[model samples]
Target chain A: MWTWQHVLTTVFGSIIFPLIIGLAWGKLVEDNKSFGGVLAGFFIVGTVWLLNHGIGLMYEPQMGGNLPGPWSDMALAAFWGLFVADLLEGKKIELEPILSGILGGVLGGLLLFAMV
Target chain B: MNFRRILMGMCTGAFAGFGVFTIWPSSLARWNWLGGWLAAGIIITTGWLVNHYAGGLPNKEGGAWVDMALSIWLSALLGGTVVLDPVNGLIRGAYGIFHGANLGGAFLTIILQLIGATIAGYFLYAARRSDA
Candidate 1:
């Protein structure tokens, strides 16, 4: 019985974190077409999200929530689209970098709230 | 100078902090000052560690987009784990920020992180280029 919290954490850890990683960290280090960076970003985000949920258990015994599978899917899809756009454009988009992340994080938070 | 890398470390630490407070507001009150400092220290260390180890490699085979993507990805995972709750808590407590307080502020955080990464990357790229 994966609760909503579990789902939110997973989405944050897996999808959101990865997307951010792909965009931010990947931009800094990788130079090989950005795919590895993106993949690594995905992995890192997923791990962080999971770590947060795991940490939650220490404070509360019964964390509750349903995993928003569709939300997670949408998040992933959006990130990939962004990644592809970056790839085709031949550069990382000149976005207000921190602002973009903040927007993404907020959206993620809202999604979590809704799911919960 | 190495200062840029250190700066990046700080920036990443800050973002890590923001992420925690924003995502899990419930945990904010439990942590004290010491707890928060410990957490921030951990994230800074993690950023340094990642930069120290797997950071030298660049997206040489690809375009600028590739390089930036890799850097962001590395930071996100490294930042998320190393920063953890203690660090995140410390950050929020020190800064007096909260989740949903600056609800749509991730973009700002990301910009800071990017600035840090760019500085670090510039030096790293320069060093690597010199080496080759």
Candidate 2:
């Protein structure tokens, strides 16, 4: 709950985890097609939505994932974090970055689901 | 005149908020996370202890302390499930704003809604005053 572990994990998982995933997402489309970041973001959102509702896909600590607390915030932050990161880094907002972020966010969600 | 715009903005915001909420799930509110399950468990335990020690006498509410205890856990289940409340719609939309960098204008949408909602609230209050 409000334990130190929960608070620390919240920062780690919610902010740091998403930032890392978002950074990678930025690179996902830098080299390839420069299209559909919005669409990709939608998919990432969709995957997380599925994970949240899907019976067996939970990231429960008592279960396999051992996530300190509910990690859906991290899942959500993953898709949206890229844009925030780019803005802070002063990176120009272009079609490609958005496209990669969302597309990569989808990948991140799926990857986490598989691992959990 | 201006009222029309206010209504429009409110409608648009509600639409957008609900849209975000449609995707937002209560996974983050996991019953066990952040002591939610613990709260329920403690209440249930307290109920049991009361029943065992104090004879679980019925109260004015027509239910025993133990019966009330049973409700603590049963009702506690709502803490997490309650994410569906309309206010959570705003919460979900706030999360969606994280994508504003890529999509742009996310703030404007929320701002318009804020103004619209304020004006609407005023009218609601006004309606209660017959003299107005």
Scored by lDDT, the top model is 1
For candidate 1, write residues B1-132 as lDDT tens digits: 244443443344334333433333333233533333333233323432343234421212333332222323322222221112543442311110111222122222233333333433344444444656
Best by DockQ: 1
Kindly report which residue stretches of model 2 are placed more than 4 angstroms away from their true locations once superposed: A31-116, B1-17, B24-132
Please, what are the lDDT tens digits per residue for candidate 2 over residues A20-113? Answer: 3333323533543233233223333333333332322222232122212112322233323433333343444443222322332333233222
> Cα lDDT of all candidates, in order?
0.33, 0.29
Clash tally, candidates in order: 54, 3
Per-residue C-alpha lDDT of model 2 across residues B2-59, encoded as one tens digit per residue: 4443333333222222222222333234432323223222322333233222323122
Candidate 1: global Cα-lDDT?
0.33
Error of 2 at A46 (Å): 5.4
Q: What is the lDDT, from 0 to 100, of the residue A18 in candidate 2?
A: 38
Per-residue lDDT tens digits of candidate 1, residues A1-116? 44556444433333333244434554444554434434343344333433433343111121123210111111222233334434444554433332333333433233233321
